[model samples]
Target: MKKIIFILSFLFGFTSLYSQKLSSNNSKAIKNFNEAIKLYENYNYLDAINKFKKAINIDPLFIEAYILTAQVYSDLNMFDSSIVYYKKTVEIDQDFFPNAYMFIAKFSYMTGKYEEAVKYQELYYNHYKLNPTQRARAKIDLNIYYDALELYKNPVPFKPINLGPNINSIYSEYSPALTIDDSTIIFTRKVPVKDKAMEQEDFYQSKKLPNGNWELAMPLLGELNTPNNEGAHTISADGKILYFTACNRSDGQGSCDIYRSYKIGNTWTKAENVKELNSVSWDSQPTLSADGKTIYFASARNGNMDIYVAHMQKNAKWSHPQPLPDNINTARSELTPFIHPDGKTLFFASDGHGGMGGYDIFYTKKINDTLWTTPQNIGYPINTHKDDAFLFVNASGKYAFFASEIENGYGAYDIYMFEFPKNIITTPVTYFKGIVVDIDDNKPIIHAIAELFSLKDASIAGKAITDIDGSFLLPLPAGEIYALNISAKNYLFYSEHIELIEAYDSLDPFVKYIYLRPIKKDQIMVLNNILFDFDQATLKPESYVELEKLYNFLVDNPNLVIEIGGHTDSIGTKDYNLILSEKRAKAVYDYLISRNINPQRLRYKGYGDTMPIADNSTEEGRKLNRRTEIKILYNN
Candidate 1:
């Protein structure tokens, strides 16, 4: 025995004396590993990873160190590193096989390596029984992977069809918005009104029935309607809130401001203006996102109407309104926006991008969090040479509803529904027809000016002159209130505020009848009421009231004017009657002058006995001819 130099180069340097030193080093390594564990527990994963790496370097064979280091890498989302270390642990000790395999499976799933994840998951499952929580989590991940695989393999076929009369009506009804579950629907309907006094448009709504046929349409109740005009409503996904436009009054912030209302049970509460988003310019046509976290609307505040958006903050307040990205809003008008249920596609009507003629339906798809692609025109058959706006699509991404003019329509415009194919849809249209007559006589009032004012934009939108039969036709946007004014030369200004909340589903045209009183001499009419005075060569203060009526009449007629002549009773000399009548005629001229009536708009002449209709011999007859008369001098 060569002195048996048992130079024990202990495999891990564990000579009895060296064992103490090795234990000390192990303790140091253990201390470092424990510090890293503490960091890992607090979720300081990056720092913990550094500490774990240092500990493993000091003790290359520290099995526990390798296992925890792999876990720390996994916590930091370094799945590849976690897999490498986990594999090393299993290689060093077969006993750690199952746990290593399970971690590798989890990491693979985290990295989207679904096939590898499934293979390792099977191995883990074969050796270990997972608790309920682990099983549930694993199942969820599996389902996600399966769905993603399916999505990648084949995209779902999107076939859009036009919702026929089952949901739409002849009167303009469109801009359909619905709740997330598709249980409720809120849409705009431009229907005719019964006894509508103003020239403004009309709109109404209908609900879905159990059998899927929409129930008879009804106008929205409560204070949401006005005689002015209101429509283009947007309902939140829950169907609990509505936003619309109301215009033509002193309370408006501008031409129109956005308004909101909340549904309480079957009725809606009073609507309040969305002042935060309104400006001195026009604002209308609001559309809310499916999540109710964003609002899109049209505004003319920047001189031309364009689309803008305001985000809903977590605190329930709206953020400052900002113009929509360049892809959506342009210099031209962009209105009637509809955000689809998927919250990834935006549909809107735009005149900026060239289309069929007027505003055409277009769509844009969201590419990423802050990016959207250029819009695509919903081409040909769906659009036409006229204005085609206010679109609504159902939950299945099929079936659309909109407003259009059809042959033999009941009124100027009507709502229609057709099979709008995902690829191509024929233009569908309808109309609402009715007549306007004297409310008292039931006879049609001719040449009466009918005006429709939008309550949302607070401005006059459309006007029509009654036909020879006192009948007029008007097109309406759905879900709005309108103020109708029907004024004739001698009739009291006929006015009626129409609320279209109930107009939808009411299969009849909005029948309107107006009564006009005659204006003649000795009618106790105001003379300044007639724009004249006794012996004065100037117009009096009260003259404007009557002259304004005349001015408005002229304005409405556009091509009508007359000569105003004056006469007197023969209670004086022939020279006196002629001279007196002439003075009276000039007096009438002076009166019109003060009222800003154009001199060229009138002619004046006096005929003493020349134009008398009654005998100057009797006081009654003389009084009748001692009058002022306006004869139509020009008519176009």
Candidate 2:
């Protein structure tokens, strides 16, 4: 009844004259009222409104005509005139149109007259009997309006800036997705297809200008687009892969199926259905993890539309989809799940959970693989009593982007970003980017995984794989030191220690190049991270991280024997340097032996001031010269 009342209140308020004769006996007034009803039924609202006013002028007591006039005005979006007619009818005779209470309440509620709406709503329910569904909805809306009051009282401090004319157009733009660095935004734009009556949605992208404003959006020039619609997409943190929604396609498994495309250099490959994740129902609105190993999306496969997640298997396949926990997915619809690059925080929209009403934006933190904390609303103002979903945030967590059909927009809907206060920002992150190539031919190495581990605790921090171009980016929590190990089949593992504690921002990407050497003899590489006490032979505790990498390499190649060579800068007497370098080399050999490596397979040697790879005249060069290196001696 609440929904019907809510909608009807906006339509025409009417009297309970179902079995009675016309109350107004004026023949001309009755004729005009009948003509007005026919015009209203045919959706000629302006003509119906004029006829209704004519009937009222002839018979001022025509309450039904007054109700019809209000309905026409409301249909025209003239809420003030609509409310005036509704109130005039009430003043003449409240009982003549008891349903007018509900109509007045609806107009009041829409115009920020919450208290008046509530007052009139109570009068409506008390006067009429409600069915079970109506009562339940009424109760829910009542509580929602009360909550909305509180939300309006205390709003979150946000500054939303329009993306400007370059990005918006006379057509609708919505469902904005951004790269980890916020350099590009892809959105869906509805445009008329020249001669066709039906509008089409296409994927459009806007590049961020040097001044930071987005440039004019253009349809994707690659084969990712077709005559059919393509929308609701999320870009991988590295901006290499796009996951999106396409409906009613021949290859689709349901009404809407999730599709993906890979970025080859600057062009996107053809779209392919994510067959593993799609079902015979709706499966759309996908979000890819920062590491590109997990997919989160909304699906109705489980009967109720809920958020489901799947993992990227070791063979580069998707795992079986599993619905999120009850905390995140309720019996009602839950959609638009955006897992932030940090991987712990999740933002989505839900109508099932208790909210201000309709679908409201919410956020939660993943407690573990199968559990998440109860969602908290992104807050009022940002989320109104209408449907609001599809929110994306940058790696820095400073701003959030979403679509809105707000006033003064360029068209139907425009994308906007809100600067979030510190309270709502998630954990800060810094992206580590690099390219992987084969040293033999300088060709790109695709699908190589870069595993990041925390040196402080040896915990796995994050992972990212090289794209077709051998370029990779990993978003790690800022202010930490990590040990990054790159792995690929039939290639020797590469290890490096990175310290990003001083990089307090996520905007500037840190780049490093990795040259993967093939598994061959005579391959010599430096372990510049191996450290020791000042001029002493004892290894520092932090040096164990690099030693562990050596240990693993040895364990992975059991039959191989390596000579651990230590080099010293020309800082002391040659004789003294040789003795110290030999002890440092022995320290590494001893650690490997302790890790169960055969003592006979390892050899320790010192080349003091004899094999300096860099100039020992400068402090930086001297630091690089005092290092540990490994040489492939034999593999049988």
Candidate 3:
């Protein structure tokens, strides 16, 4: 079988297996064999095949000629034909070639003959003495055959849809990345140059139109893509940072090093080589987390290509990389890692752990933020007896994209997307994203920070800073209520709690167009995220984060004094509502006083149900009415 990424000399090169065994008792066969060997040495595979066939026709029992013919076929990548010829040699005399059994077992498994492949493997093991490496390989092969047989018996749905011509080209395209909203997609495409013999890999981008169709893809504009190759990249969730592979560059610390770029206004800055991430060995295929704090990549450092993860520290320096657990890496190689935005399900291609065939895609979920669970094969049709790598699961967990080099694709390799079954999905993710604009002129506020917190625990779940266009995106899981806070330098902070119910396949994204009012006197803003105990003066623990924002605001603008107004819904008597609202306002007032603010600058009021913003008719209206608000009292 072909090793997918790198070339292994032992798998492709010939072993000197005593070439004089059948050097013919007949002079005719002897001449043909000598000529065939000469042609094979010159790399003339077609003519060598003919010469080997001539010798086989003369002496049908010539085991040496049969072995040479099979080697030529394997070199040509006609693996089925090679297997047939190898089997013919073994059938003539079971002990004719000792390595024939192993080669036949390998090719048979590649062709999906699992039972026969296992049979041949066991036969080779029992009849011949084994070396340490070869014996371990045989054991792995046996396990792989059983896995193939088991998965083939009960196949999952793997009907992949070809991403149409708008994304794919007459050349090759692969390694897809997308933001949480799925509006833009970035991938690597290799197109032929006008006069160059070799095709260079370049990044391309496409956006989904309002009509829900992808636009024509074009080359990505950045200094990252030059005459040299740049590919195998991952885009952060906000679509502002990019991490990719660049080889043989002047600034590279190794043969291939990982590089990163920051997007500044629809244009990317010059890439910088991540010096701490690279070593003296080949390193590439980077997958960065949504928050850009964690990264995983494939490296050939510990004598084999294995997956290693590195973490970015609070000081903005990356720590040393550590290899993944033994369950994921093997004596063989693993490559093409895709860590889902949810940060738990990791999909990667591997040949080390036993699977159906070459580099099958497997996924494992993270237990906590710590160790990962054991790897499991995705399924049969999704993972065939061929190389499958570079899989991407969109944030919604609806579909996946990967590259395949098959006869039916556009060219040497093409990107294909498959809609996963509901059960096969990664963790469900919902998004809340849009542009933050100035209410005065509707211009984007480019420096806004958005924070999301779990309503249950009052702990922050995620956060994002707006990009150049004042656009922010945050990924959240379903079945939870999250409180959000958006703030800027001179604007009133926006606060609200969003609810997302759990549903596996159907997710509706929340698109918010936030308009912020500038800091001015008499401007009233509701702190919707603040909470209080029922019918009591005590502030709930969840109100601390929001109150801290208010305290900080007071400290920043010392001349500004404000009134904390409390209101209630029309659910109780007028006297009860009035008392409850007063106590709640004082609860906030005392908390601020304890924080050492000037007490003379603060005042409290209870509007009760008199200043209701909504009708208080439905439950949703009642939710809106029960809120704490702040108004600018004096600016002097």
Candidate 4:
């Protein structure tokens, strides 16, 4: 009763026939047509195409031969040849017009001729009311075409309606695999099935109806539906076979193994565990490339869950799984890898590096046939503090589908849809810009420490020092929130929060201005905040945490340095105050010493309050005046 995942595809079948009676006049035509069928069955579609043309030439009205030839040319990806023969078939026999229209619609859709495809599909439906099954399938494909049209022509806001009780239960259900034609949807459902004492998860599927709703779901009964967990599946592009994950059992190679099932007639044959894939650890979340030649998935056998890929051999056996390079997988988890339909981009979830949260969606592009560039964060709005994974983008690469925990969502994790900004979706770039200044004067303040914190985790993402003109620029992947902190001594710390939500195709400057206030004695301040230790000439461990503010102030104004002086009230003997204050002043001097401040740039004196701003009679006044003070000795 393990969860059995079924990946289904929609397929339409047509019949082929040679000339019924071999009359002397049709003998050469029959011979050519028979040879063409043999070549078509063997998948020598291009060669079979020429023979079919010869047959049609011998008998100008060989309609069935024309239909078969068009199908073969379509399979060979020669859409122009396919369209010619299909049109010719209908010209010879008007009764075959609906079938011809269907082929033309499909070819048009494949070639991105949406308007033409829609026109032809509508014609097919109007001329011939197909059987219940054909109509059901046709409606689903029509819906897909319409969806594709909406995705391309308009930037329609996405409103994801929850599947509700009919499709979702307390159990899990996800990872939908659709046929290229979109007539059928196969998704994984985890449902508890009872078998004597034990209960386990099992896979079930529902078919689309002519009315656009789904039919009642039922289990896929076959050898593939085993008593062990079998979920996470993918189907080949042509819709002939399914590749899925099956857990370790008496028949499995390891903890979880990849398996495949071939379609025969109307049912799937016995499942065959892919012996070439499984290792001792774990391997799952399989995805097949659109061409059906490459398979990508997650595996922990090489240590953590990293993405790996395999190739389909000429004989249809899979090669050994090869781990993706370091650019894609670090010594951390990388899962739910998806190879987009475009075949150049790969999207996956990783915690390795350069991310906003624990797990964020990342992508890498194949610069050429063999080279993959560095991975990049997809960015905010689409990514959040919570996990954002399991991504799928359509052929046009406009809208994308992923899971998120949006407010009022249907479940703990509900599927959400989003669009990449038109510019970034087309072309992408990196780099950020901003400005810093003094709060009181409103003048630019250079050399302020600007630390960037990731809003996803509130961790320090990066740091940059403002330049001479009080401007800073940093490189960042588009789509994120960052906290910028600017601080300098004798100045109030400045903070600016920025969110880069919009996608950009080229370098876009994020104009920002920061203001910092001057620090003075009347201003309430945290003392240990400035760091000084007890009974010691050496600065405390925590000293620089605050003193760095002073250091930065000096760095910002190279011609400026103040006298580091310490004062004390009458609590101690005047001699003791004089000597202790000298030590305290020197401590500040030495601490700045360790920081590479030139001795020529600093000086120290112990006044012991020969000049006291507050009365020593009160404890508060004594505390205030018996303190450290820095006066600007020089300013340029």
What lDDT would each prediction earn against the true structure? 0.61, 0.82, 0.82, 0.64
- Candidate 1, residues 519-545: lDDT per residue as tens digits? 332221112133234444454443343
TM-scores, all models, native as reference: 0.39, 0.75, 0.88, 0.40
Clashes in each model (backbone N, CA, C under 3 Å)?
53, 1, 0, 8
Q: What TM-score does prediction 4 earn?
A: 0.40
Misplaced by over 4 Å in model 4 are 1-159, 195-199, 208-213, 402-636
Count of backbone collisions within predicted model 4? 8
Candidate 2 local Cα displacement, residue 169, angstroms: 4.3
Write down the RMSD of all candidates, one decimal each.
23.7, 6.0, 4.4, 24.2
| Cα lDDT, model 3, residue 544 | 86
Lowest summed lDDT over 10 consecutive residues: which window, candidate 3?
1-10
Which is superior by TM-score, 1 or 3? 3
Q: Please provide, for model 3 over 515-568, each residue's C-alpha lDDT reduced to its tens digit, 9 standing for 90 to 100.
A: 888888888889887788777778888788788878887898888788999999
| Candidates 1 and 4, the one with greater TM-score | 4
lDDT of 2 by residue, 416-465 (tens): 89886566554677778889999999899999988877777766666778
Error of 3 at 99 (Å): 4.5
